[model samples]
Target chain A: MASMIVTDPSSAAAAVHRLPFARFSNGLISLGRFVGPLHVCSPTTTLPRTLSLRSPRSSRFITASMATEPSAKVIDGKAVAKQIREEIGADVSKLKEAIGVVPGLAVILVGDRKDSATYVRNKKKACESVGINSFEVHLPDDAPEEEVLKFISDFNADPTVHGILVQLPLPSHMNEQNILNAVTIEKDVDGFHPLNIGRLAMRGREPLFVPCTPKGCIELLHRYGVDIKGKRAVVIGRSNIVGMPAALLLQREDATVTIVHSRTKNPEEITRQADIIISAVGQPNMVRGNWIKPGAVIIDVGINPVEDASSPRGYRLVGDVCYEEACEIAAAVTPVPGGVGPMTIAMLLSNTLSSAKRAYNIK
Target chain B: MASMIVTDPSSAAAAVHRLPFARFSNGLISLGRFVGPLHVCSPTTTLPRTLSLRSPRSSRFITASMATEPSAKVIDGKAVAKQIREEIGADVSKLKEAIGVVPGLAVILVGDRKDSATYVRNKKKACESVGINSFEVHLPDDAPEEEVLKFISDFNADPTVHGILVQLPLPSHMNEQNILNAVTIEKDVDGFHPLNIGRLAMRGREPLFVPCTPKGCIELLHRYGVDIKGKRAVVIGRSNIVGMPAALLLQREDATVTIVHSRTKNPEEITRQADIIISAVGQPNMVRGNWIKPGAVIIDVGINPVEDASSPRGYRLVGDVCYEEACEIAAAVTPVPGGVGPMTIAMLLSNTLSSAKRAYNIK
Candidate 1:
C-alpha cells in the first residue's frame, strides 16, 4: 500500500529506500492523495476501530492536467525587499527630519570565514542602501571572549546604535550563549536573546525584535496576502534561528502550528496537513510534490548547495523544497536564492528602524 | 455524513446544536470512529483530491461491550505527588545535613481572596511536610505596587529564600508583568519568568524551572513509562501557564506536538490523532469519548466547578475531559481534583530544592 503514491517516481523511490519502513509507510499513506485515484487509505490502522473518512470533494487531487502548467505565484523576495528598503529609507528620512537621528546597526564579526565576511559586507551594504548607519567591528578569530563581551557592552550603552547583530559561527573556543546573552535586550536586533523569544512566545506580550529569518518569512506571507489566522501551519526543523521561532510566529497570528523536527516519526504526514508549509531543514529537495497539499503556500527557507554542471559556479543554491514540482502544485511558492534569502536583511533593517523609533518614542 | 458518529447520542445532539455547522461538521467527521461501524469518514473534503485512508486494523473502534468496562489506568496524581513530597523531604534533609541550609520559599499575597489564602495555606503546609521553610507576606488590597516590589526585592536578596512566588491576581491597580519580572530568575520557582519560558522553548537550553502544572503532567507520563519519543501528542490549550509550556515540554521530549486552541476549526480530528493528550482549556467535559484515540493517554489539567446538586458543596470539580468517557476509551487517564491539583505544590517544592542546590553548588 505504501508503494503506490508517487508524484515524482524517482524521488519517492529514493525516499522509500532512505527512510525506515515504518516511517516510509506512515509518510506514504499521507501522500496517497497524490495518487490518481483517491482511495480510502486509512493511516489509523494502529488505532482500534478508527475509520479513515474521505470527504466527498476528493476531486481536488492533482491531476495530469494540473501538473503540466506551472501555476504557483512566485513570492519574489528580492522585489519585496527592495520595496521594504525604500519604505525604510523614507522612514529614516522622516525620523532624521523630525528628530535629527538616524537608525544605526552594529555588527560584530569574530571569525574570518569567507562566508561570514560576505554576510557582514552584505549587511553593511544593506544598511547603507536603507539610509541607516552601519558599524562594524572585525575581531580576530582567536580574540578573547571578554573582548567580544566588552564590545557588546559598549554597543549596549551606545545611544546611536539602535541594533546590534553578532555574526554567527563564532570560534569554537568562545562560549556562544554567554556572548549572545551579553547584548542588552534593547539592542538585540538579531533577536537571539532568550528574553526576546520568551516574550514572543507569551500572549499579550510583544517582542522588541523578532529573529530576522522567521520574521522575513512572515513578512513575505503578509506581503503576498497569505491568510494565516485559523490556518494549519507546519514548520520543518527546530533550529533556534528558524523553525522553532517560525512556528511561534505563525502561532502568534492564530495558526494551528505543528513543528516537525529530525525526531518526528512521519514528517511528510504531519506536513501534508498544513495549509502553509515553511521548510527550513537545510535538506535540499526533501519536500516533494507528494508531500504538499495542493494549493498550500510554501515558504522554503533552505539554501543548500547542489551540484550544477551548467552553472558558472560548481554548485547551485536550492531550497528545502523541490521548486519545480512545487510550482505546479502550490498556490504560492518562495523560490531559492531570491526568496527568503533577501528578505532576512530587510527584516533586520526594519527591526533597527523600529528600535530607533522605540528609543525616540516615535509613533 | 457528519451526524452519524456518537458515543453518547444525547451529548452528540447537544454538541451539534450548540456549535456552528462548519465547526460541528469538522469535529464530527473526526468523531466518526466512535460509531459502531468503522466507516471511512474523510475530514479532508476541503482539500483537493485527498483520500481519507483508514488502516486495515479498524476493528479497534469503540463498541458497546468495550464501552461497558472502564479499563484505563488512573494516573494517581495524589499518590504521585505524595511520593514526590516524600522524596523532597529526603532531599531537604540531605541538603540540610550537608550544607546546614534548608530551602525557603517566600510567597507574597496582595489580595484577600479566600481561594488565594487557602492556596497559600496549603502551600505552607506542603512546604512544612517536605521539611522546607515557608515565609508569607500579606499586603492590603489598597497597598501601593511599590510596597509589593520591596518585599520581592528583599526576598531576591535573601540568601535563605531559594524561591520567591508572588500570588497571582494581584490588585487590579498593580502591573502583573512588572511584579512577576521583579523576582530574580534564579529564585523564580514558579517558572513564570520570560527567560525561563524562553529557555524551555529553545533546543539545547535548560530552563532553571518549569511551570508546575505542565511539569507535573510530564512527570506523570514519565512515572507511568509512557513513550513520548516520535509519538503524536496534542495539547488542547495555549495559555502561558499550562497549555503552552506543556506542548513545549512534549516537543522537548521528541513528541510531534500540535496545539489546538479556541480558534482551531477541527479540534476533535486533531485530538483523535494524538497518542497522548494534555487538555488544559478549563472547559468542563469539553473532550468527550469520541475525541479519544483508542489506547491514547489523557492528562486533563482543567479543574472546573460544575453544578452538582448530588454533592454537599452544591458543585463538583470536573476536568476538561469527560472522566467516564475517557476511562472507557483511553489506556490511561488523569482524574480531576485528585489529578494535577496535588502535584503543583510538589513541583514548587522540587524547584525550590533544586534552586538551593544550584545556589550551594551541590550536585
Candidate 2:
C-alpha cells in the first residue's frame, strides 16, 4: 500500500483500485440513521452519547433534488485515505524495526450491534494493513458498568496498548460519560475526552489527538490544497464527534466558521455564504443546489442509509449532500461513501500511530 | 452594597449614585496602556501568557477624543455587576444562616505587580461586600512554583473553602498551566483547569465552573437583554480567560460565533459583519467606526489605558472597542472601566457562592 493514491475511477486520474467503503458498507451507511446517530460513533468513537441531527418531523425544509449532474472535481476520500494508510504503513514498519515496538490499539465495544461489530472488524483490518497490533473486548448489552470500566483500566495500564477507543453508543443502560472518562487522557486516542477538546478550543494549546472524522475532513481539505484561512466556512450539525470539532479545526485554520443547526434560522442562507461547507447532518438530500454557493468546496460527513429497490442490500449509502447538485455548483465535493468514510478509518489509524510514537518517545 | 444597581447616570433609571469605576480610576482607565495588559489577570487567569494588544511602539492608534460624545445606550456593567453582587450576597447570607456555610474564596497571588495586587485587593473587598469569607496568600515574585501548589492543595483540602482563584501573570517565572492544573476541579472556582474548559466545549455537558471574566461578559449581555441566540458574534481576543471562553459561552447560547485574533486578516471587515461584538484584544482604540455594524450591540472586553494628561493617573481605561465610535454606531456599548472589569469580580462572587452551595448541598 505504498501511498495508495487511489485513482478515482470517475476522475481524470482514472486510477482503478477497489474502494474501501464497499468493504465497510454497513458500518458507514448505517451510521446516520441507526435508530439514532448516537449508536454509530466517530472514526475513533468514544462512548456514543446520542449524536443527533434532528430531522424535523415536518420535512418542510427538505426539497426534492435533481442529482444526475456532475461538474465539481471529486476530492476522492477513499484515495486520500489509502494514501495516508500507505504512509502510515511505511512509518509503522520503521518504528517496529527501530524500536522493536509495533503501535497497538485497544477497542472496547459494548452490546452486540452488528453494525458496530462490522466497524470494529474493519478497524482491526486497517490496523493490520498498517502493521499495528489490535486488541478487542466485546461486552454484552447487559454488562454492568463496572465490567466496562475494568477493561478500560486494564487497557490504560497495559504497556502494549498505545491507544484506547471505546466504540460509541454503548448499551442504553451504560453511562457513556463515565465509561469515556475512565479512558486516561494519554490513551484517549479518540480525542473525545473533554480536556483534549478544551485544548482544541484554546489558543496556544494543542489536543493530544483530534477526533478522527473531523480530523479527516480537515486532512482532505489540506490534501486538496483548499485555503481555509480567511475563507468563510459553515458546518452543518453540532455533534461533538464531527460538526463541533470540524468547526473548531476550521477556525484554528483561520476560517471564519458558522454552525448551522436545528435552531438556526434560514440555514440555507447562512450556508450559501461559505467558501467551504462541511455538512454532517444525516438528512439525505437536505442541502439543495441553491443552498451552496458556486465554487464552494463541500465535505459531506453524513453516511445515511437510503432505501433503494435497485440495490441487492435494499438500501444505498448516501451523504447529507445532494451530491449531483453540489457537484454542479461546488468547485469540489467529497463523495459520501468514498469520501469522509475512508478518511475516518484512516485518521483512527493515524491517531493510533501518533499515540504509539509518543508513548515510546520515538521520533 | 444591597443590589448595588449603580444607577446608570446616563440611563432613564438615573437614580443618582456614585460610580465604582470612578473610584477605581487608575484601575479602569489605565487597563490598556498600563505599559501592557499582562499586569491584569483574573480569578482564573491561567498564564498571563504574552497577552498583548500590541502598543505598536507608537501610540498611533490613540486619537484625542472628547468621551462626552455619546449616542449608544451604555450597558452599565458596573450597575449590572453590583446588582449581581447584591443578589449573591443575599444568597450567601441565607446559606450561612441555613447551613452555616459562608462561601469562602481563596486567592493566591504569586507576584507583587501593583495592578495584579490591586485586583486581588478588590476581590477581597468584593468578597466582604457579599458576606463571603476570603483567604489571601501573597507570595513574592521569586517564590517557587511549589509554593503556589502547596496553597492550592491546602485550599482544595480546606472544607471551609468553596473556591480558589490564582491571580494572573504568575511572576513570569512559574509554569502557569502546571500551577492552574494543580487546582482541584471542585474548588477551581477560577475555572482555568483544562477539564473545566473541556466540559465547557462539549454539548450535553457543563463545566464545574466557567472562567470569571468571560462569564462576566456573557452575564452583562444577559442582564442588558441582548438576545444572543442566532446572533453573529465576533470575539476579538483569544486569551484563555476572556476571548476564548467568551466565544464558547456565546456559542453555548446559540450564537453563530467567530473569533478574530491578531492572526486574523481583514479584522475590520469581519468586525463590520457582526450583529454582536465582544472585543477583548486589550488594544487601545483598535476597533474604529468602520469596524462596527450600525446598531450592533458591543461588549467591550478589552480594558486598555491611553494617555490622558487631564487625569490624576495621567491615563484612563478604554476597551478594545473605541467607545466614542461604537457609541455613535452601536445600539449599545459597554464602557471600559465600568464594563467588563466590574463584572469579572461579580462573576467571581457568583461562582464562589455556587461552589459553596454545591459543597453544602444547599439549594
State which candidate has the highest TM-score: 1
**TM-score, every prediction:** 0.83, 0.80
Tens digits of per-residue lDDT, candidate 1, A168-239, equal 668999998798788889988878778888988988788888988899899888877677989899998777
DockQ score of candidate 2? 0.41
- Mind giving the per-residue lDDT tens digits that candidate 2 earns over B1-363? 111222221111111111121211112332322434322221221111111111222312322223334456677888788888889988988887887778899988876676566667777999999999999999999999988899899999999999887876577779987987888899888787777888888888889899887888787777666678877888876667677788888889988787776555567877887888988655656677778776688888665555567878666665666677676677778887687767777887888899988887765
How many angstroms is residue B293 displaced in model 2 relative to the true structure, after the best TM-score fit? 3.3
Per-candidate count of clashing residue pairs (backbone under 3 Å): 19, 8
- DockQ of all models, two decimals each: 0.63, 0.41
lDDT (C-alpha) at residue B253 in model 1: 94
**TM-score of decoy 2:** 0.80
Best candidate, DockQ: 1
State the TM-score of the second chain for every model.
0.82, 0.79
Share of reference contacts kept by candidate 1: 0.71
Give the DockQ-based CAPRI class for model 2: acceptable
lDDT of 2 at A150: 98
Compared with the true structure, what per-residue lDDT tens digits does model 1 show for residues B1-363? 111211111111112122221222244322222122112222211111111112112313222223335657688889888888999999999999987999999989987876567667777998999899999999999999999999999999999999998876678999987998889999998887888889999978899999887898898888776779989999987888788888999999989999998778888988999999998765557788788887788998866555556868655666768787777678778887688777777888999999999999997
